[model samples]
Target: MSSVWAKKVNSSKSGFILSTRASLSRASIVGGALGFPRIRLPTKYLGMPLYKGPKKSFLWDDLTSRIAARMEGGEAKVLSPGGRITILKSILTSMPLYLLHVIVPPKSVMCRIERLFNKFLWSAKGQRRIHWECWEDLCYPVEEGVLGMRRLQDLVNAARMEGGGGS
Candidate 1:
C-alpha cells in the first residue's frame, strides 16, 4: 500500500534531516520569540544600575541591603554585547520586545560569563571593562572555537527543530 510505503520512507530518513531541519528554521517559522529577561531596576542608563541610597550613584555599596542582596546574588543579568544586540533585535521584531524594553532592561548570566571568557579563555586582563560584542564571538565556530554560549539564532533554530514553532 502507498500508506505503508510512505511510512517506511519517512522512517528511513535521518532524524536530523526529518527533525533537525525544522528546528534549524524555527525563527523563520515563528513570528516572534521571547528573549532573555531584562532587569527591573528603576534606572535611566541602559546597562548600569540606579543607586538610590544617599546620593544618586552607580556604586553598588550605596544601594540598600535589600538591593545589595540582589546585586551580590548577581541579580543584574550581564549580557554580552552580542546578546544585547539579539535582545535589541527581538525588540525590533515584535511587540514583546518593545514592551520588555519599556518594562525592563535586558538581563543575563553573560556578565560573568563574558568576564571569564575574556580573562581566562582569551588570557586577557581581568581588570578592565569589557566592551560588548556579539554572542557569536563567544562561540567556537563549527570547527575552530571552543564550545560556549548559545547562539540566539541557533537556539531559535533548535526550537524549530524540536517542533516548538507557532504561527
Candidate 2:
C-alpha cells in the first residue's frame, strides 16, 4: 500500500491523499498539476482487495471468479483427469494461499471456490461428469481415503490456526 503512495504521493511525477489539511479540490489540483489519477481505497493491490472494515464474503469473489474463468476456458477441457488433479493441487490451490493468510473468507466464498474446483476436476471435454465419490474422499491420503488436492476449508482452518498461533 505504501509503495503505491510512495510513487504517487511522494514523487514529483504524481501525487495522492484526500487529506484533512487539504481538501479534495487541493488534492485534485496537485494530481492534475502532476498529471496523475487520484487513487481511492478499497482498491486491489497485488491481486487482493485492499479495504477497511470487515472481510466480507463478497470481497473474496475475485478469487473464485478467477478460478471460474480458468475452468471456463477451452483448454481445461482437454486435460486428462490426472492433469486436472495436478493443476488443482498446484495452480488453483496456490492462487488463494496468500489471501487466505490475510483474511478468512466466508463460507459462501469458500463454497464457490470449492465448487469451481470440483467442477473443473470432474468435467471432461466440456461435459459434466457424474461424481462417483464425495469431494472430501478424493482430497485425503490414499491410505486414509484418496489423494488429490487439499480442500479450501482445510486451508481456511490452517490459515486461522496460523494467524491465531502467533500470540
Candidate 3:
C-alpha cells in the first residue's frame, strides 16, 4: 500500500499528429484537452522525412547531408585503401539503402551522392586526387579482382526494377 499513483498527462510537453490529410484540426482536440502544442508538416520522424507530396530531389537533401556528416573526417591518410573500401561498402553506402528501399531517389541526386563517395575514396583532406579507377570498374564483382562497390545509380535502377518499373 506504499505505491503512489502518478496519473498526470503533463500538459507542458508538446505532441505531434501526423495525418495524410489536414482536413480536421486534431491539434485543437489535444490542445484543449491536454494543453499540447500542435506540430506543423514537413517534419521528420526517426530521422526520415514524413511528407506525402511529390517525390522531388530536394526532399532527400537531408539524406546526403547525413551521409557526408558520417564520413566527414577524410580517412585517406589514416586508413589504407582496403580499409576505406570496406568502410564504404559496409557502412557509408549502406546508410542510404534503408531509405532507398522505401523511396527511389532521382538519378541526378544519386549521381551527386556517388560523386561524394568517389571523391572520398580517392582524395585526401583539403586536396583533390585522381580517381585512378572509375566507379563502374570498382563496382565489378569482387571475384573479378576489384573491390565490389555498388554505385548509387545502380541501386535506384534495381529498386525500380524490383518494384515493377522498367529501367
Question: Which candidate leads in lDDT?
Answer: 2
Candidate 3 lDDT, 34-80, residue by residue in tens: 67766666666666666666657776788898887866765545776
Scored against the true structure, residue 6 in model 1 reaches a CA lDDT of: 41
Clashes of 1: 13
CA error at residue 104 for candidate 1, angstroms: 18
Output the lDDT of residue 69, model 1. Answer: 34
User: Against the true structure, what is each candidate's TM-score?
Assistant: 0.22, 0.69, 0.69
Candidate 1 minimal-lDDT segment of 10 residues:
11-20
Local accuracy of candidate 2 as per-residue lDDT tens digits, 1-167: 35554433545443354544567788778877877766665667667776666767766777888878877788787999998988888998898999887766677787778777888888899999987776666777767857657877778778777442211
Off by over 4 Å in 1: 1-128, 141-143, 162-167
lDDT of each: 0.35, 0.75, 0.73
Model 1 C-alpha lDDT per residue in residues 29-107, reported as the tens digit of each score: 3413332222233443443454333433233222223322332333124545454335333432232222223332222
Candidate 3 lDDT for residue 51? 68
2 or 3, greater by lDDT: 2
Per-candidate count of clashing residue pairs (backbone under 3 Å): 13, 0, 0
